[model samples]
Target: MKLIFALITGLVFGTGIAISGMMDPAKVLNFFDLAGTWDPSLAFVMGGALVITFFGYRLAWKRDAPLFGGCFQVPTGTDIDMKLVGGSALFGIGWGIAGFCPGAAIPALGTGRWEVALFLVAVVAGFYVRRLLSPAGSAKAAR
Candidate 1:
């Protein structure tokens, strides 16, 4: 049941990304090109997602436990460090350059775009690079 739910949820999310023009690098790049032919549609898409997430979180919080867990598996780290900032900057740069973060990229690859393969490879490389560099990443050994 959990696997089914996860697959269904992922399908819905990927569908949303594709339908919203978020899967297209050109659309995202156009949004960034504010001085030229800027597409403001991405802003609306983000706003809609934010609204949905806000409400979803509120609803989730009202429950004592989630469907798959006793409590929310929230991130414990709240520190602002150079590592965090630098990693975020890199992610932002990659997203701007490719317009396909990990989630949407998978479905894009399923649609047979060769570009997504490169994007996925880069994403994996970035993950390994971070694991190699980050001090907090010693948890990998424990896992």
Candidate 2:
């Protein structure tokens, strides 16, 4: 049941990404080009998402638990530190360069594009590298 829900959720998310033109690297790249060929569509999409998420969280908080899970897995971390800042900067750099964050990239993999595949491979490699570099306990916490 949980797996079925997950698959359905992923399909819905991918469909939304595709329909919103988020799967197109060129479109995504244009969104970052503030000085030239700037596209504001991504901002609209993000705004829509933020609205939905704000309401969704409000409703979810009223419930005792999720429908398919015993409890929510919300992150408890609230401190701002070097590790957080560095990771966020790295993510932004990757997104600016590749024009594909993990969410959109996963669906883009179906397009049979080598660039998309390569990006995903590098993301996996990054995960492994980070784990290798972290202390044993920190690595587990990273997850």
How close is every model to the real structure, measured as TM-score?
0.87, 0.91
Query: Tens digit of lDDT per residue, candidate 1, span 3-107?
Result: 899999988988998898888888988988899989998998899999999999999988899888768766677779986787679878888877777877888
Over 4 Å off, model 1: 135-143
Q: Estimate, for each residue in 56-130, the C-alpha lDDT of model 2 and write its tens digit.
A: 899988999899768988888899998789989998998898888888999988789899899999999888878
Best by lDDT: 2
lDDT of predicted model 2: 0.87
Query: How many angstroms is residue 117 displaced in model 1 relative to the true structure, after the best TM-score fit?
Result: 1.3
Q: After the best TM-score superposition of candidate 1, give how far the Cα of residue 44 lies from its true spot, in angstroms.
A: 1.2
| The candidate that achieves the highest TM-score relative to the unseen native structure | 2
TM-score of 1: 0.87
